[model samples]
Target chain A: MGTVSTVLSPPALRTGMALAGAGFRRWATYRQAMLAGAFTNTVFGFLRTSVMLAVAAGAGGVAAGYRGPQLATYVWVGQGLLAVVQLWGWTELSDRVRTGDVQSDLLRPVHPVLSYLAADLGRAAFALCSRFVLPMVVGLIAFDLYLPHRPATYPLFLLSMLFATVVSFGVRYLVNLTAFWLLDIRGVIMAWLLCSNALTGMYFPIAFLPGWAQAVLWYATPFPSILQAPVDVVVERGTAGHQATVLAVQGCWAAVMLAAAVVVQRRAERRLVVQGG
Target chain B: MADRPTTAAAYRALLGAQLRAQTQYRFSFALDTAASALITLLDVVSVLVLFRVTPALAGFSFTDSLLIAGLANAAFQLCDMCVGNIDTMREYIRTGRFDAVLLRPLRVLPQLVFGDFSPRRIGRAAQALVVLVVALSLADVTWTPARTVLVVIAPLSGAVIFGAVFVAGSTTAFWFVESGEFANAFTYGGRDFTIYPVGIYPGWFRAVFAYSLGFAFVAYFPGLALLGRPDPLGTPGFLPWCSPLVAVLAATAAALVWRVGVRHYRSTGS
Candidate 1:
């Protein structure tokens, strides 16, 4: 709070933006990879949509508190958000940590956490335009999506999405930071990947789970905040107050995760040996 | 042709070496096995979660659906254990490792696949097998001798089908370095597609993925055969028993594709 006034000074802002742009450019160069990702997402979108819609139809046009259109929104939006949130397949930090490139990163003027977050934000931005857009259009054409009835839901959903990205990056950063201590982080990474995909609303809606389980997942675990909360916001899962509450929870997780990531990174930096000449 | 026996022996030795090396790291193998078991557990939980929302999915009840899910998953895991490393073809090509691979005496596909083979990966298939057994006991299907025979044959046929799909999908790596995600659209995507009732999908999707691509034969038809039930979508009655035939056809196509891919490899020459 004390440094808020100078936080956005031109130099700092420029550095953040430059790193973000570099991140965007680096990812954008893999155009075919992006296309393949979108294609895969769209395919899964169709499969999930069909299954969820069948559930909805089975339950007499509503399944797990979601109507047909809402289910469509959930599945398609989930497919798009899957790439933007990047539930798995990120190991850049850990790779750098392995090769001792992280020492150079620490030598830079900018904080490592902040700089990496900026780059991730840029990657998310590029994904938003590329892989994300395709699923949105495909969902619109293939299914009846629930376009947010309330005007305020739009911005709130966007905010929740941005926060989801932060929460995801924070978790990812902490997971990668394990490489400093565990040279072979494969087990840790595998555990993270399994949990994120299985529990994080990637395969199916958590709402379909039993009430106790859903409550535990939404409130106790960060997985729902990373995915389910934002989709809930878009589909207007609850009243205005409830939407606000979900967003607030997601925001809190974002901040907590970021702070935790920074602390772990600091500890890791002190212990980093940078072995080999 | 006369040297086939030696080639087979050499391949077994290579795969044995890989398995031995992997088991040397007991902790990592154990963690992977635990994670694999956990993943299978979650697969059941996800399906149960879906059932909590509705009584049935496209005319299949919870137990009925589990039969499909278990068979599909067990078969998929078996295939993954066998030829999943074929996906590393892109990296091998990019890192100029394929040049050395080409210099080898044995065939390319078998070498690439068996080179990293790990039998411990059967951990996942074992978990899926548990689910299949549970589904058998709980589900309302009347067990007959024919049904028992079908159960024994289905998962093996399904593995063959899935293995073919994997090889066919990875074949694209010969031309496109970034073909991994595209291959996943069929490989992993097919697993996700098969775990649910195929009748739930739309007609066109079922035609392309379930029938044309042979994903349905992995579990759907075999499941129907086991249950002695006809498909809700009303295909021919004998479709359920045709999975072995489909598996053969798909494997043949995959082998042909692999040959074409190996021929197309001009080598990075770096």
Candidate 2:
């Protein structure tokens, strides 16, 4: 009874710990890969800073709501936060579905969706540590990167990042699920990527957007709550409350996406007939 | 030159087979194309919206930025379609299917080129045309023979240069199998950096492009010609129309690296 009861507890938590362990194992083996990734990211961060500085140059005191040093701080914070948020690499579950490896996953007592999410969170967290953190530290040394002043910002920033990760993971999960229903998902994935890039402000700051665009972002997508909100908290330490509100918005969005994913996965599983020898 | 016609016919046959295989699920293909078109359209829209926020970006007006963006989109899509096979070559190499191409009668390059043709690239290309049209309408350029020639050659040469970059990147599979990820940075990441004018970058970044292999062809010189702006890099007048020259050089570079890669593949037998 004890063994079975322990097994029957929430699959997400049990699988989450197991998957996180697996992530750590993978990280150990792929240390070199992660280091290389960090180096590449640091190089790009420098390039991006140059572009922003060029744009903000010739202006008097403040350009795009940031002074020179503060703007540098924003870029460093954004890059560091990128690890905690973890945006790159999509189509994990979809590839499994396509290759028919998902058969074993479906047989588990834990829902395949939850299992996949747990596993992804594990892998992404490892990548974040090895890739994002290391690079940002190097960037801080080389570029005189600034950190947030107030102590309160750290806790709120962590909270915001966690919320952002959940929301982003949910979005990616749902996007991957579409491959189960659709025969060719590359185009759809590409299109989704384009939207996510705009919404998440991967290319630029959300503050750079126009009023109508900002309104559209708030209502139409959960993008602003992801990268932009977390970075906002870092740059403006006093705005932790606003960041918390954004985190709340992100939680709601996550719940909505998770619900949608469950429904879709159920429907797709019923129709899923993997035809092979 | 002797086998050009036959090679062309063979390429068409391969393309037809690939398209039909894709079209087997017609509804999915149609839906994907529509969705992709919408998504790409939104990306352009986002840029326009950003431009509306501020009258200028790094001293570039909305219309000028649109022109640069349109050209980049068109060039990238064309390259994507042509070398779509190379993008997946690492998988083929890992699975040992690359040997099958080596065993074929035709040249390895032609066989590779004909291997894959993603129809979705057309969606990207079409979206780029819409961007170009909008930019043209906004600009007050009097359409002349010279302008038409510049526009036509600009995207074509840009595609060639970009395709060469992919080929060079894909050839790196010969040296480091896992280097595919980093190879992507130079092509896709480089395209992003180049979409804006070279002048916007720092002196060091500009120096890399000036000295780097693929940068001049992809965006630097041709963009100057297309924009009709004085060469920010102090390039000569004739250098602006140096697209074809860049294309030839890139192709030569790709061919040489690919030849060396083929030798490596033979020796490893993997």
lDDT of 2 by residue, A163-182 (tens): 77777777778777877777
lDDT of 2: 0.69
Cα misplacement distance, residue B122 of candidate 2 (Å): 3.2
TM-score of each: 0.95, 0.86
Please identify model 2 stretches exceeding 4 Å from their true place: A1-15, A31-36, A58-88, A141-146, B1-9, B38-47, B140-148, B214-217, B226-228, B232-238, B266-270
Could you give me the TM-score of model 2 versus the true structure? 0.86
Q: Per-residue error at B223 for model 1, in Å?
A: 1.2
Clashes of 2: 0
lDDT for each residue of candidate 1 in B176-217, tens digit (9 for 90 to 100):
876548888898889989999898998899899999999989
First chain of model 1: TM-score? 0.96
Question: What is the C-alpha interface RMSD of model 2?
Answer: 3.4
Residues B1-270, candidate 2: write the lDDT tens digits.
778898778889988998888788766677667776766565456456545445555666677767776677677777776775687876667667788888877787767777777677776787777777787687555566776887888778778878888888887767765553656666765666656656666677567754465565565565556667776567678877777778788888888887888888732355
Number of colliding residue pairs in each model: 0, 0
